[model samples]
Target chain A: MERPHNFSAGPCILPLEVFEKASQSVIDLDNSGLSILEISHRSTAFVGIIEKARELALQHLNLQDKGYKALFLQGGASMQFLMTAYNLLEKKAGYLDTGTWASNAIKEANNFGKTEVLASSKSSNYNYIPKDFLVPEGLDYLHYTSNNTIYGTQMKTFPKKENTPLVCDMSSDIFSRQLDYSQFDLIYAGAQKNMGPAGATLIVVKEDILGKVSRAIPSMMDYQLMIKKESMFNTPPVFSIYVSMLNLEWLSRNGGVPSIEKKNKAKADLIYSEIDRNPLFKGFTALEDRSMMNATFSLKDEQLGPKFDKLWKASHINGLNGHRSVGGYRASMYNALTLDSVKVLVDVMKNFEKTA
Target chain B: MERPHNFSAGPCILPLEVFEKASQSVIDLDNSGLSILEISHRSTAFVGIIEKARELALQHLNLQDKGYKALFLQGGASMQFLMTAYNLLEKKAGYLDTGTWASNAIKEANNFGKTEVLASSKSSNYNYIPKDFLVPEGLDYLHYTSNNTIYGTQMKTFPKKENTPLVCDMSSDIFSRQLDYSQFDLIYAGAQKNMGPAGATLIVVKEDILGKVSRAIPSMMDYQLMIKKESMFNTPPVFSIYVSMLNLEWLSRNGGVPSIEKKNKAKADLIYSEIDRNPLFKGFTALEDRSMMNATFSLKDEQLGPKFDKLWKASHINGLNGHRSVGGYRASMYNALTLDSVKVLVDVMKNFEKTA
Candidate 1:
């Protein structure tokens, strides 16, 4: 049976080759007569795997040898909401309120210190990105969500300010595009999105931004300690990191971020064009601030919902429904989502228009 | 090639059948046409998987319908060290420091509130369980390590005190032996040892013991919030939880904890008898407190290390080397480790004695 076109927002699709290689390793890693699950995190073999993953993550982001350390930590990006504050929020931090996750990051940071909302798109129901926001001086760091998965909005340009560090929760769109990677001092992404599976979170941080917080940080929440220990603070999510390493290797072999960016653009163009041309459908989010990773849209005729749902289901489309906050449909096109899958959805949309 | 006996401390061995099932599921889950890795946490399929894992965990511990909630959380047991204190430590807590991890637990708890050491075996290099520790009145909770992987010490009996909530970090020994699990108000274990893989941590908490502390806990660290959210406060480590559910199913099918305990005792007995009978070997921990899961022993003749190592390697033994704190051999016999593996190690030891 053919695999369906997976469009789940975050924890979405990964390359089929990664699943195959990871599945094989689960039984026997390199014919070592031991399952990858059984291998010790302290073993030289696992050490090489994690180190290679860290290297590849930086390489894909074009940030190698640029004073940044990549760590494969647990607890997902949600944990980073607190950990980023624990490690960096001493006096005050600035956050751009973009969507549900961005608001969550702000809430977690407020527990540590004063969090200033530098800008917000909440008034528009996060339909657009807040642009040309005034920069506040003396802030510890300016944080923002690079892409809002639920609202289907992405930051086309980032907040640039000297003397204030830039932090980003790029959980939904981290290796999907090429940008000025070094502009952000810290960037965290949950592995469920473009990386690999759910357990491990990739955190890339500049060495100098740490050791500035005054509060007593728990060892597990301390980034400096994790960096010093080479991300083996305590038995890392071994299988998650290993599979992530495999995915990173896949990303590298497929021409890194630049090549994938072009493909992502093509997938986005095909779907968004269909949404615009179809009379029965309308796109969610502002046209100028639309997300390339997740495109949210709705049927113009509410009564036609059942027909459209049946069509997508018959076409073997998975996770096409939008989030509860925005009731409609969402088509997530991650790096591993082939352009052919998007074409299938577009074909379904075109057929639905004639029948309706 | 024959599979080696894996005795690595944690992130250790699991059942072979679990590995096979998990490997197959990574490619296709229950004929769903979706790779398990790609499924959303909120999907009905994944919700069933996580709910089953939680139910199985409770059923194995005999804590079903007993006001205890089993949560498959992330960040390992290290995160629990702080989270336990964050949620339960109101004024002061008592701790029994048995090994490296217990001490770390105490250190993290101290950051929250006053922590009193009831007793410690650290003076003797943690070679014994500190017994008959005096329990003080008015303490919020009493915490101890159920099994010390590095020292090979197990608490054969727990400290019982009226009205004091008992918290145990059962990372290495959970489900390996049957105990009165209801006695402890809270228990947390990293899934790598005797559970499944190295990503998910199983946290079983008696609902009444929480919400007593005055300190505000971070959302990710807050147990009450996680319980309310059904462990889906954010994207959980889905693959790890699925594999854990598979392992728990394997455990349930194999007669749950009671039957595994008997097999564990048999393996422990086979190895401990050899350690005593062989002139070159001596046990690390006290005889009364020797852990059934891990047997730490060293050669009396330092020069025989090379010969013993070579014999074990030849006999397909893996992770036999002890931690650096105690430079010797540690044969970790987790739940999934077979008795045949124990016999292989014993045979290697007997051959080493004869050759030397």
Candidate 2:
């Protein structure tokens, strides 16, 4: 059966090969005569897989000797919101409230210590990224979301600061592009978007950035302890991490981050160009702050909504419906989506323009 | 290939039908044209699955009209070890330390409030349950492990209490037997044992048991908040819960807990009778306190260790090797293990005795 072109905001599309391998593993992993779902996480087979996942993550990011340790954890990025604060925040922290996820991080941090929203795009309903802002002095760290899934905005340029550390929620666009990963002191992403599934979170934390806080961090959330234990602090979401490893292997085999970035840009550009040129469509995010991952847009003529929805659905495009807050469509072009699929969506829009 | 009889303590065996259906869903779930791993948890398809899982849990437990709410949560039973304390341990709690897992629960609760060890079997290395214990009055709750996975002891009878609420960690044997569901206010289990996989936790909480604590519960750990949101407070472990729902469906069709309990007893009795008669092997837990889920035993003649190990491995048995702390073998028979599989292991043991 032919698979549909899926553009889900999260728990997003994955490589077909990875899915195929994972399906076989769910039946019997590596001829061990046990489903990957049933094997003990403490077993040598699974431990090897997890260790290799962390190693490959660091290797792909070129952060192998850069003092950053990669860990696979549970509870998604939501749990990381408070955990980042519990492990880092002492007196106060600065947050860039660019989107819902960033605001949620600030809200969770307030329970741990003083949190100041240094900049916010909320005033504009998160249509654009806030640029002109000063990084306050003496803050433990300045946190921000690398890409906003709902708002379709990406921080193309990171904030520069002295003395304070940088933390990022890179859930949507971690490996879609190349960057100097050493600049951030801490980074976390739910494995759903560009990685694998929804159960595990990928955390990359610098060693020296931990152990400064006075609070007793829960063992599950403690980055320092997770590093010490090699992310076996708890049972460690085995199936999610296993598939993540397979996805990472796919990424590495296909020229790693830079190659995927090229494909991602092509997909984004194709869809966004259609949104810009088509008379009936208009993008929701500002041009400069537009996401290379999620292309949020709406119909210029409201009456065409039903027809455009039908066209995309008929074209076998799944999850193109935008977030409710934005009231449009979001074509999430993650790392795995083919450029040909993007062309198919663009062609669908052209046909709709001719028909509607 | 013939499937091995997997006896893993946790992340253990699942029904073959559940595995097959789950494998297909990983490719295309219910012909929705989306991999179960990639679909948004907020989608109607997944929402229906989660709702059915909760409804089925209540129905199987005969607690549908008993004012109980079932939730599929993330972070496994380890997170619940902390959450149970965060939500319920306001001033002090009573804990019955039956084995490693119960002691771990007590240790985590200590960070929340004062805790009294009401009863413990530590003196005997947790080989038996401490029955001659009282559930002291004026306590926030009495927490105990329903099954000791490592020690192979199960609490066949729970302590009778009047005022204190009862909380249980039923990770090892949740659906393998039937019990008085209305007796406990809260019950949590890691789904890997009898349910499905490792990432999701099955929690059954009485609506009235929450909101008594004064401490600010983390949103992810707050039972009241989870109840209000129907466990969609965040993106859950989607794939894990979906398979768990399928496994629950399988359990319901295979005659729920009462019927499974009969088969579970038959399996346990067959293995224990062999351990008592074979002369080469001896049971670990005392006869009266032995578990119907995990039957732990050791070789009477340690010199025949390699010979016995090879014999079982040749017979296509998996995960019979015990934990390092206990230098023996533990055969964990969950709801999915069949009577014929138990016979295969019993036959292997008899063959080993005759040869040795």
Candidate 3:
């Protein structure tokens, strides 16, 4: 089977080698005479896979001694939006609303504790991340979604901490860039975007900050409970975690985040530069805060949008449609996305310009 | 890759056709040139798959106009344990504690509201399902685990559920028996046991019985919110749902649950008869209440248990070890396990008996 450049946003393209390794195990896993699905989460074969995956995820994030523990959990990242609040929000929490997912996270966090939206760029249709957010001193934590996947804006820097903990929902752009552990006390992302599959969520949490919440959390939802059980609180999504490990292995082989971040910037630069140069299209996000992972752009002529979509789909290009919450084309170039895929988009843009 | 008789308690076996069909789609899904993972959850490819899987599941259970909505959500049946209590436990809920999972359910449910143990079989080592448990009047709902997977006991007939809505965590024994779903208002199962994989959980709930709870429920944990969104409230486990759909199709082709129930009984009878007749071993659960899905037994000469396990594993018989919480062997016969596999186990028992 010939592989095309897959760019569907999360549950997105895993590496081709990952597909080969994962598919082989489906038929016969680890010489256990059981398909990987049938292998027990408690079995020795699966334990090794899970342990390796957890270690690799932590190392990839450079989270060693970062006052945080990594957890592979089910229910994707939307779940962590709630779990994070449930576990952390004993007192008031502050949020910076940048885009759709960030607003959703704030709404979910509101259900648990008082939420203060320190700033919002919604009035500008979220073109730029809010830079002047009022962070009240002594709040429980200052929470923000680091990257707006839908809006294609990112917080290039963390808010100054007045001793309040920082929590980030870094679902779309976690490993595609470099980060300092000193800035944030907690971070979580679904493995689908930059990591691997859809089932597992990678949570890095400061251990001491947990268990301070006063509400009666369901045991499965408790971060401290999950940490004590070593992410085996229930049968973890075994195969997804294994696939994520393979993805991380690929990342490590290609030189870690610094190397990948440079590649990611190059890909985003090529596509965004095309949108800027061509008279037919215009970039959507605030230019100062445009993302390296998701590039949201729109045609200057509205009628050409559908035509462009059809053209891309015909070429077997995928997941370039902007989120339904926003209307345009969003070319999400996560870690697995190649510079060559970006070249195809650039070519399409140049051809579209010649015709328009 | 020779297949073994996989008796994994959960994260269990699936039909070969289901795996083959699913694998083909993994790379090039539904003619979309996208891995099923990369395809949009809202795409016609996935919505149809999710809806079809729900319909097939309801069909297999013979449920009709129960006004029940089927949802495929994450967090497994364990999440349902709490969600059931949150939705229906406005005043109080009743639970029947049977095994490890049952007790876990009760513990989670207690967090929502007041819970009473209507009955328990722990005194009998969970070997006999309670025949005469009392159903207290005026309860919001009656919660029970249909099959105790670890202890290998099943309810032959539920205690008469009248007026009270019957909510069951049917995680272990669903699809293995012919059931009158009218006896219960709600039924849910983690798909790992009899259905397909670990990532997706199936919940069947009556629409009219919801919204009675007084507590503020988180959106992900709220059944009504998920049903309203048709389980598209968040990005769901697309690959897991697709595989479950393929498994459902296979089950329908194999003549639905009625046909499968006959085979399940035959398989259970073969293994149990050997355990009863052979001097080397004895069945753990009572004859009337033993589960068709999980058959637990141990050597009469306790010293030979380790030797028995070694013999089975050496012959490539896998996942036969009992849960650590319950120290004995448990052979799980999910829908994917054929009668031939059961025959092989029966022959092994006979050979071991003669040699002993």
Candidate 4:
């Protein structure tokens, strides 16, 4: 049976091949006569699996041997919002509030110390990425969200500054496109999008930026300790990391980030072009700032939502509904989603347009 | 192919039927044409899965509709060490230091407020559970580990006290035994053992116990907010929770905790009986306090170690090596490990003794 067009904005789509291998491994891992779920996290096989995942994550981002370490942590990026501040925020930190997640990161940071919102797009409902932000000196770190999944906006250019450390919540758009990954001191992404599954959060941090905070960081939240323990700080999400390893292997075999980036661009272009050309719908975010991962759009006539919804449902589409915060349609095009799936969605949009 | 007798401590054995269903769901969930890994946590299907899992968890613990809320949070029990303190540690908290995890919990709680060690078994290398410890008045809560995985000791009786809240880390032997689970104000367990896999942590808390602490709790760590969000505080460990839901369904179908407890007792009895009867083997922990889940034992003659190892390996035993802290063999018979597996291990031990 053909797979449905999965556009759910994370806990989202991963490679189908990864799923097949994971399915087999759940019953019997590498023919070891034991299920992956039953294996100890400290087992040699699991250590190798997690190590390879860490390696592949850095390799995809072109951050190998760059004074950086990758960790597969739990609690999603939401936990990282607290941890980044827990380990870094001593006196104060700077935040670029692009969307809901960034605002949340700032909220968690307030529990530790001062959180300076250097720039925010909340006034405009986070419809576009805030730019031309002035950076101040003596800040512990400058934080930003690389991609705003809820608002359908992504940072095209990162803040370039010296002395201050750069931190990013790349939950929605890491490994989707090639970038100067080493430029950021710390980067964290929830594995649900463009990686594998939901449980694991991929944190790639420059080692030098740690140990500067005065506060005592909990073992689970301490990145330096997690690195020292090799992401096995305490029972690192076994199955999540294993499947993530499989997905990263898939990404590596499919020409890594550069190759997948081209495909992602194509998918984004196809859907966005249709939304622009088709008068019945309008894109949500600014054209220049629209995310390549999640393309949020709205029907021109609110009364025609039922008609468009029916068209998409008939075409075997899934997760087309936008977040309630942003009332419209969101077509999340993660790496695993094929371009043919996007075409099916565009066709549904065209059919809806012609019919309504 | 015959499956190995898996004796992994935690992230240990789960029902094979759960594995089969999880395997199929990974490819396609209930004919939904979508991989379980790809479904959004907010999706209707996933919401149902989480809700059912939560209900089952409470039902198995016999804590349903008794002012208890079950949350499938991420970061394992390690995160809960900090969270329990972050949310509840006020003025002073008492801890019963049974083993490594208990020590770690006390350490994390120290960062928050005054943590009084009520009693400890560290003097004897945690070989026995400390008994008849006096419960202090005005304590915020009394904390203890229900089962010590590394040391192979289980709490047969809990502190009988009123007024002071009771919190227990039931990570290893949660569903393996029937208990007055409502007596404890809060209970947390890592899903790796007796539930599902590593990643999701089950937290069962009474509603009235929250919002008592003065310190500001982070969103991810705050149980009240998590309960309010119905465990969807953030994108949860989706696949882990789904597998846990499946495992819980399996447990429910197999007659829940009472029925599993009898089987667990049988497995523990079989292994312990063999250890006592076989002259070459001696049990590790105190006989009275021996764990039902993990039966740690060592060879009487050191020279026969290789011979015993060879016998178990030949019999297809896996994860029999004990924890580094306790240098012996540990046979962890979780809820999924059949009595036949225990018999196989016992036979291997009998054969080893006869050969020696």
TM-score of 3: 0.97
Ranking of models by DockQ: 4, 1, 2, 3
Interface RMSD of 3: 1.7
Task: List lDDT for all candidates, in order.
Answer: 0.93, 0.90, 0.82, 0.92
Every candidate's DockQ is 0.87, 0.73, 0.62, 0.89
Pairwise TM-score winner, candidates 2 and 3: 2
Give the per-residue Cα lDDT of candidate 4 at A122.
Answer: 95
Sort by lDDT, top down from the best:
1, 4, 2, 3
Reference-based TM-score, model 2: 0.98
lDDT of 1 by residue, B91-148 (tens): 8999999999999999999889999999998889999998977999999999989999
Candidate 3 structure quality by residue, lDDT tens digits, B248-268:
889899999999999999999
Collision count of model 1: 0
Question: What's the CA error at residue A319 for candidate 2, in Å?
Answer: 0.8
Residues A63-177, model 4: lDDT tens digits: 9999999999998899999989988999999999999999999999998999899999898889998888899998999998999999899999998679999999999999999
Question: TM-scores of the first chain across all predictions?
Answer: 0.99, 0.99, 0.96, 0.99
Task: Please state the Cα-based DockQ of model 1 relative to the true two-chain complex.
Answer: 0.87
TM-score of each model, paired residue for residue: 0.99, 0.98, 0.97, 0.99
* Tens-place lDDT digits, model 1, residues A1-356: 79999999968889999999999999999999888999999998899999999999999998999999999999888999999999999899999999999999999998999999988988878999999799888999999899999999999998678989999999999999999999999999999999989999999999999998778988999999999999987999998899899999999899989999999999999999999999999999989999999999999988999999999999999999999999999999999999999999999999999998
Expressed as tens digits, the lDDT of each residue in A237-319 for candidate 2 is 89999999999999999999989988888888899999999999999988999999999999998888998899989989989
Docking class of 2: medium
lDDT, model 3: 0.82
